[model samples]
Target chain A: MKPRVLAGLLTLALVPAAAGAASLGLGVYGGMSSPILNDTAGNGPQYGVRAPVTLAPMLIVEPFYAQSALGDVDQSFGGSSYTRSGPDVKMFGANAVFSFGEGVKFYPLVGIGSTKITQSGWADITDTSLNFGLGFGFRPMAKLCVDVRGELNAVVTGDTSRKFGNLTAGVSYALFGSE
Target chain B: MKNLRLILPSLLLTGLMASGCWLISGQFTVSQDLPTPLDVDSQIVIVGAHIDLNTQSTYRDHKNDLKDLADCALLGTFTNTGTGTLDILVYMTPAGSPLHSTKVQLDADATKIKVWGPLTLGPGASKKVGWDESAGLFNADGKQALLKEVKGDGDFALYAVGASAPYKLRLTDGVAVVVVDAGK
Candidate 1:
């Protein structure tokens, strides 16, 4: 897991030198993530931060961290009953972005990352997964851009194939080059 | 036409976002072993003990809504550690204290309502005993009569009964496991 996370970070570090980035930016966002299947669990809130490095007008690499809260569930076996709290999920990874427009950008991205899931009465589940998504970013003012995104993360595991949907909205502050 | 193509994907993404918990989080059937009062391994019990079901993380906010509890299971297993064969039973305790936790002798109390079983166990043996009518783990779909005894933060009493096992006195280890399918 350490190797994989390190590899992701290395990819972020090395992409700029290989492609020649035009700008560097920092982003923060928050929204709700619900079970994609609809039958399993309810929607929960999520928040995240990211560093987006533009390698070209159409290309960027983003390294990010997202934290989420999940809803609880209940069960009963005849006389015995229980309520299991929803697990909290934390993810760290990077995405390769392909931007479509300038100033107001429509981008689709794909990448991989590691995830850790935990709950009160259950054992923690940690795995790496591939995630892909789309985003629309526009500057409401100079040096600040409003960002909105929707993504699906497929957690890698041998036991069960798990995935989640995340939708977030926030702002990106320019660190250098472009806002 | 170009803008429409761009808007279409965002619309589709929004539709997926609104549709479901597509995040196939690998949360599976979670099972937890509950703790009992006077909880100890190989505890001696001729009478009964309150297996506290209230100590876990239960949702207090939406506890009243029945939909929140529709999909789940509770499983129980007990072991007899004595040298002789023994008979054991789970009974619903009287109303005030719990749905089922009697301090005194089980049979001596007139109001005891039987929940689980008079499961016979050989010396150093264990078996599954829940609301189900099965040989192994309980897959009971029908609610038990004493289901209300542990509906919400309630508990029941399990004790060795009958004269077949040394005046109903037996050294035993018992645990009830509550399981809920996260996939549902």
Candidate 2:
């Protein structure tokens, strides 16, 4: 692990476990994602615990780690029996989510995070990307809420690269926060 | 051969430089949809599969095939098929010929399939695949070095399906153990 990444993860992990005024949540998320390589669609399963440290009523910082599969993509030639399978892509990231709204009914959110993606079968062929996410959540109770999210991850590799996106919906159990 | 030697050393260096560690855990279940067989004591099924090695060079050179390939389980028997029994084949199938099968057994639980060896169950019985690892892959030390040496490109799939339903009895339950070396 790089020094910066280590520092980032440590900082996020130690996010003042005291749920003071902020909202802490943990959940598992899974859904379909359009991979950057070759595939019609693939399943991505992610499990993470998120804690929001609110700088203000509308701004919160959330850090997360997730393992996802890009699925087996077909890259083999048309007539060749020798077909190739794509490796699974595992990722981890931390984001700053900006929520907008007042009443505890509904709120819209947008955020950005730095992501580290690892490709199986291809060791060291890793990608560190800047991802932007847009989503919303509704909290009907004091400790429970549901959120739907989508993110566009742009990975930079010296010269040419691509943008990948994933959309998922999940329910969260809050340790503390306003209803 | 000279170029191959040079490339091999460079690849080794690259692998060393990129070495880190990983912890992976997940659950996989195979639900078979086949007709049940009638009048049978028990039945067994085998499932074999290989993990994918994603790379263009490996795919072209067939390096992925060099790694040792083996399935932990042998065969599982489903015996409680009272009126009739349904036998179905389940496993990740390879793309090309010479299909591989990972044999599994019916665990004592009767609901889950214990993939270690042969298992016996009565008629009308279904089983799910389950495995547990406490420490995980990271505990394997530098064994990841072995992963680098494995370079053949292959995808997982159900290669063969030979099950006996209650109405039609086709094949009987059996066990087969084979060790596959990459060089072979």
Candidate 3:
């Protein structure tokens, strides 16, 4: 099936599920992301928004949109130095989060999504990839939750691929449920 | 509960597989300086002159068509030949008028030819400078102003003012009458 059709179907399925979920949480997050592959010196800030739907006592599905700022990289080739400024990236994806415990819960998430990178003086590149992450969340008050996560995203285009790691912190409001 | 245990392990395995280097595309580099031979103090002379026509075209329905673009570039090369450094101001004025009277001092060695600069020389040094014909002349404020296009054929003169030790040097080259005949 076409990726767009599959994405549309997933969105349709989520609407009903989210409407009947036990709770929904909306949050904003900011973080640092670093390239793990070639020329790893280009690291930048990433910020995003996410909405989480609690389907059952320990199961949650979250969809997110995140963007990374333009990063500058200095490279030396053949004894000459050149500066590369950009390749800012944007990611849109959804994850199935599995919560292990209450109050302070540890969750492992598996996700899939698309990423687009735009660099100055070069054509833009877009690809789809799989995401993996581990996070911990704590609720100190009834409506307030704080979470931290470490995530890895593997982006694949044709036969080549690259990976990026993100360490993020977020705050969420319960909106409609108890933690 | 049994299903949960199985699903958790499977998810963990997928996560591990997905976590690794894989998230960038092509990189582009912008070149700031051109590669030219560096020589010591050499006689400052105009080596070449030409009018470059900038052209463009597009492809449509398996056919390529040219676009109407009249931009051109004025190119020249200046060579310096002296044991001592020579501070010079090289500029272009309307073919017959006195070189723009605005005199600016050269403060640094690497100043752009668009402004007054110290062109240091040891024994042989040369540099190539060019201006976009459409950019017109440099104003008193050291900024490009008076945008003008080359019309048919016109004559433009190149002049250089330099000071080396006891003697001040001023040299003017024959007028360069640029014939704007782009692509017959």
Write down the lDDT of every candidate, Cα atoms only: 0.55, 0.38, 0.51
User: RMSD to native for every prediction?
Assistant: 12.7, 15.6, 15.7
Q: Per-residue alpha-carbon lDDT of model 2 for B1-184, expressed as tens digits?
A: 2353344335434533353210011111111222222122223443333334332342334342343321111222233334444434332332422333222332221222212212223345544222111001112211232223233234322222324433212222322111122221
Q: What is the interface RMSD of candidate 1, in Å?
A: 10.8
> After aligning candidate 2 to the native by TM-score, how far in Å is the CA of A142 from where it should be?
1.7
- Mark the 10 consecutive residues where model 1 chain B has the least summed lDDT: B133-142
Better of 1 and 2 by lDDT: 1
TM-score versus the correct structure, for each prediction = 0.52, 0.42, 0.52
Q: Model 2 compared with the native: what TM-score?
A: 0.42
- In candidate 1, what are the lDDT values of residues A1-179, reduced to their tens digit? 36256547656665644445567788898999875532234578999898877766676667788888877654553345434466688888777777888778898877667788765523456776567789998988777889788988766443233567888898887788874
**Superposed Cα deviation of residue B162, candidate 1 (Å):** 16
Query: Which portions of model 1 show Cα errors greater than 4 Å?
Result: A1-12, A15-20, A38-41, A76-81, B1-184
lDDT of 3 by residue, A1-179 (tens): 44335444655667887888888989899999887642423789999998887887778877788899746665443234334453688877777788898679999888766787775422356766567899999987887789999998766654345567899999887689754
Leading candidate by lDDT? 1
- List model 2 lDDT by residue over A26-127, tens digit each: 655665555543222244544445555544455555556555565543222212111123335445555555567654333333332344444332223355
Docking quality class, candidate 2: incorrect
Global Cα lDDT for candidate 2: 0.38
